[model samples]
Target: MWDLLDPYSYEFFVKGVVAATLAGALCGLVGVFIVLRGMSYIGHGLSHAIFGGFAACSVVGANYYVGAGAWGLGSALAINAISRSRRIGADAAIGVVTTASFALGVAMISIWGSRGASFDAALFGSILGISPTDLWVLTGVTVFTVGVVVLRYRALLFTTFDPEVAGASGVKVARTDALLMLVLSLSILTTLNVIGVTLVAATLVIPAVVARMLTNSFAHMLVLSTAIGATCGFVGMNLSYHLDVPSGTTIVLTGAAVFLLVLAGTGGRRLSRTARSAPAPVRPEETVSLP
Candidate 1:
């Protein structure tokens, strides 16, 4: 078994391991907010927007991460601005931004001539192709994300749970939301190299969603989500190597399996609780105040 794994062992494999773990951990950390604030679609939009950056960088022979990060940040800012409008709606805003950004990226690629390889690996992650430079960039993103989330945890939490109250308490809810969105954008950018724009949401949403099913506290949910994400990355990479499959798809499948298992474990119990609670809610006055 060890010798079989030896063929998979190399500098590239090491880089892949490091990149995936860091990306997973960072996504899990930021995903807590994504889940709480209903910003999962924001991850989706930002991922596509970052892909635009990647395309432009590829055309100009620049570093892809830098380009992707820039576009991701831009996407975050766009989402923040649009979502502030009461008319657009958050989900609608994300859809508009993602579609426009993606179209722009595709147009850029078309104008530069169809060099498919750069975008191909980006669309479907190639863990085996992750370079040392990419690993370093990913590590830096991880550190930055961790630091920001830690520093602003309380404020972010307050905003997520009760933005009106947080604003009344003098917390700048709009600013914090924008900042968090920016962090989420970077995270989405980082994971894009591993899972592509289309599938990055799986990494951001699956582990966090599963973690939520397992735990109620935000901190515990963060920890659990990170573990699940890293495990999915590792397992999916290995499975892809062994089975000659796409790493991104395998990783997503692994996450989905975990999500299903968590659902199976707790789904019935939660439903039972909901069913049982109905009887207690029959008292009109009590029911009115209960909510």
Candidate 2:
């Protein structure tokens, strides 16, 4: 028990736990919308796209969050813009813009050769190294995201389910999309340190997907997903401390495990329901002749 509780005594571990919790909650909340909107790929794309700004900030000795947030917002808007074109599909736009941005980041890194920063940490994360400032930023972003979702709940729902109907009903579909994208960009920035650029998308996607599998109501899904994400963060951090593994990977794997469990449970229930509803076969002797 003492050994298990020992890691919590350290300030860094505490900070990492707080950071992971906040990041997980924010990702889970925003991810509900992402899954509903069929924009899961955008999360992965934006995570990569922000790497260019991260690399640039490293080269110039600027605040990483500010630089990355700005870059991510820009990429989000660019994706939105490209998706507006009749010639381009939304997924195609996301792929094109984010891939280009990721390539730019890679090129910058290759040219700069780390500049005393660890690319491995940036890509895979180092939760124990989370700074106080980063934690505050995560808090702010989480609060802002929740506020936006609460304030614009109806509008967001309308836009997500039926943009044409939402527009007809006086909802600003385009503006709502932009606002959602902004929130998504911020959410990605918040998770960059906790889950890193590569695995952040998993945090955004897995919990929401698991929640979706378990619930049909959107509000219930949001609550369940957020709870699942927070649980994963707390448990994964503890597991990481005990096992001496990467915190981010542990967190993501924990979520993955939950998803698998839910999948299996739900599938079993569905099969059971099907078996009960199936028609009984008639015996040859029981068959009747038609007149």
Candidate 3:
């Protein structure tokens, strides 16, 4: 027990733990909406799309988050705009725009290779390298996300689940959607330093999926997903330290393991319920033929 707790005495480990937990909670919270809206692909797409901004920022010597946020928000709005055409599906729009953005980022990196800029930190993350500034940014973003969700709970919920009905009920579905996208973009930006762009989507998705499998209640799902995400962060950080592996990969794998466990547990329960509710086979007398 002392051995396990010993890591907490180190400042870097402590920062990593705090950063991971906050990132997990934020991702879990916003992820509920992403999963519920059938927009899981957007999480992956937007993360990749931000790489273009990251590369551009590196070339220009600007703040990485600002560039990435601008790119992410722009890509998200573009996806929304393309998806609104009705001729294209949301997933298709996301795929088209995000892939192009990612390709552009790659090209920029290739062109700027002589500048000595490295994207490894953005691509794979360095959780132990988290700074005080990063923590402050994470805290602010997390608070903003939670506040928006709490204040506009009903409006966001109605719009997400039933856009037509919500619009008819005077819910301003378009504005709500834009706001959600903005929040999602910010959320993705926050996780870039903790999990990197490659694994950030997994952080945004897996915990929410696990919670969804365990409950039908939306409110309960949010709480459960947040808890599961925080747990994964805490446990995965420790595991990475002990195992000398990548923190981002370990955290994502932790969430995946939890998802599988919850899936199997829920599946077993469903099967049991089916078996219990099934009607017994009828005898010949009970199965009279129709006239």
Candidate 4:
């Protein structure tokens, strides 16, 4: 047992575990809205878009968080703006913008030799390299995300399920969407170091998907998803140390395993139609706030 748990003796391992845990929970928290809104692609797209910014920041000698954070926020807003247009679908907008940003990053890597961003580490993640500042920032982002969700619960739920009614109910649908995008962009930025650019979406998606399998209520799904994400992070970090695999890969694999187990155990019966990813109708009369 001492040998099995030997990695915990190191301080870096402890910090990495904590950072991954927070990132996982944070991703799960915002992922629900993303999923319910059929915006899961945004998580994948924004992370890639931010990678482009990360590469640019490295070239310009800017701080990763500041430059990449702003870039991601801009990309997210752009996606929202483009998607708002009637002609362009949200998926199309995400594809065009994020793919272009990713391609730019690739081109820069080809031209500038990956600069300071370290392509491999950025793509696959470098959990062990998490600094104290990054951990603190992740913690702050988590708290901020929770506050946003709590404060904007009614608005978020209403906008997520029925934007037409949400707007009618004085929820400010457009503003709510932009704010959720802001929080999502921030979550992806902070989690990038822990889960890497490539697998960050999986972290965002898997926990929420699993939670949905277990519950029908949006409120319950949110809480269960957060717990699953944190558990995956904690377990996956431990598995990464023992198996000598990438932390992001291990974390995603952990979630995937849970997803499979749940699917098998429940035999697809646990998921009610209402609990599925498609937004269930929320009539004005049923818009009473949930605790």
Best by TM-score: 4
Worst 10 residues of 2 by lDDT: 273-282
As a TM-score, model 4 comes out at 0.93
Off by over 4 Å in 1: 114-117, 268-291
lDDT of 2 by residue, 135-223 (tens): 89889989998899889887877666667766876778889999999999988877777788888899998888887777656678788
C-alpha lDDT values of all predictions: 0.73, 0.79, 0.79, 0.84
RMSD of candidate 4 to the truth, in angstroms, is 2.5
Scored by Cα lDDT, where does model 2 land?
0.79
Q: Pick by lDDT: which candidate is best?
A: 4
Pairs clashing in candidate 2? none
The residue-by-residue lDDT of candidate 1 on 1-291, one tens digit each, is: 795577455777767766777777777778767776666777777788777787778777776666667777877888877766787577877787788878888888888854433576688888765877777877887888888877887777677666776788788988998888778877777776677778888788888888777765567877888888888888877777777776788888988998778779888464232111111212211212111
lDDT of 4 by residue, 102-137 (tens): 889878777876546567767887766688998999
Positional deviation of residue 190's Cα in model 1 after best superposition, in angstroms: 1.7
Which pairs of residues collide in candidate 4? none
Error of 3 at 126 (Å): 1.8
Off by over 4 Å in 2: 114-117, 268-291
Residue 104 error for model 2, in Å?
Answer: 1.3
Query: Positional deviation of 86 in candidate 4, in angstroms?
Result: 2.7
Each candidate structure's TM-score, on Cα atoms with residue i matched to residue i, is 0.87, 0.88, 0.88, 0.93
Candidate 3 lDDT over 64-176, as tens digits, reads 77777888899888876766678767777778889888888888888875232357757776666588888899999999999999888878777666677778878788898
